[model samples]
Target: MAFLRPLGDTGLTISALGLGTVKIGRDQGVKYPDAFTIPDDQAVRELLALARELDINLIDTAPAYGRSEERLGQLLTGRQDWVIVSKVGEEFENGKSRFDFTPEHTIASVERSLRRLNTDYLDCVLIHSDGNDLEVLRQGTLEALAELKRKGLIRAIGVSTKTVEGGLETLRRADVAMVTYNLAHDQERPVIDYAAEHGKGILIKKAFASGHLQAGHADPVQASLDRILGTAGVGAVIAGTVNPKHLRENVEKARRAVGDL
Candidate 1:
């Protein structure tokens, strides 16, 4: 499979590197070290095209990512060619964020995501936890997602958790877990270890520490990804970059890091 890795037992394979679309949709409340303007539709179209050319198939978006879902729905083509992953529970509007984990909202959120993404189904839908990962899990979001999977709305369900306990619990009940992991943050390494042991999918978020770790290094991107991809259970690192050069650099570095090129 080269750089492609299995996404747990969900029967999906993702690349070692994946494109994050937040820069294409929202920039107001982001934490990137450098500020950026939201790319136009044409820019996003080209980005998606380049991603496909690089053999990157995973796309991560979320409701809290402002207009990301709507933009992807309008711009992304050949739906079957991508393994789309989106999130529910957090909503961003007018530069503010809100959370609702009720089962009713979960159902409505997935339905809304389907409409916004212009797809009948999503490969995975994660609970966009509000830092209270364990509490949010108990509020029926997982059960709701399970039902959605049964109904063919989402193939897999998981949580973008902020804590190790939540990560472990998510793997026990779901197919994937998105966690924060980077050179500066090894506190979550235990979560990745658990996923590795249990054959569960683990997607790495903040792989570059939200642009914090890239400064003051000769090649911090390579350094960060080498450490991340070298780990046993990581399925993919979702990095956001609207610049073509940066995107290509990330993919190339990630490919080299995987050592199967």
Candidate 2:
């Protein structure tokens, strides 16, 4: 089982590795190395059950991730045991993507997510950036989420940022920041550094470079997990995999990585 850790000052204890649910919902607009059929209901159920058996408590999903939130709504059991992290802003429809960062959209998005996820409150919500991280912050996305947090619709607020500048600002405005960090890309290291010093949460996306780093190498998974979980500020690493074998491998590698520290 994966161990637990605090997500900065948010007062939420999350598992060291989070399950990303993109594969359970949408498959059209993703950048994964191999094409996949969306997992059936029974498959999703077994995979989620395996995740819990492996001691993963954090589940990362988004409205942009096809029907991920909706399926999780229908499938997940014992919501109180999971730290659900979802996103607002970007929406996927008709194989196209659109972005909205206004306070009105942010507020409405959270409400919609609550309904689709079948949860009265989400553990954390992030602003999904369309590569315009600074502009989204200027648009008061965090302020709107803060309002929801105050109203008890969500427990923690943050942004899945694309820029170091945006990440720094997000740490100032919110409780957590989800940034891309992997062996192949460390440009966002500063954001993790800042979060480390400031007591803010840092969640890593693409910890295996969306599985790109898993091939043509010896022990790529362990190498990347070592650098990521070994870092001080990293609260969790979110890796989405529907394959039970790969999920088990990820959990084991993550355990060794954190255990080494």
Q: Superposing all C-alpha atoms, what RMSD in Å does each candidate have to the true structure?
A: 1.2, 1.6
Q: Which residue pairs in candidate 1 collide?
A: none
lDDT of 2 by residue, 2-97 (tens): 368999989999989999999999999799989889999999999999999999999999999999999999999999999999999999999989
Report the lDDT of model 2 for residue 53.
Answer: 98
Q: For each candidate, what is the lDDT?
A: 0.92, 0.92
Instruction: Compose the digit string of candidate 1's lDDT tens values, residues 61-140.
Output: 99898889999999999999999999999998889899999999999999999999999999999999999999999999
What does the lDDT read for residue 254 in candidate 1?
A: 95
**Model 2 regions lying over 4 Å from their true place:** 214-217
Please count the clashing residue pairs in each candidate, in the order shown. Answer: 0, 0
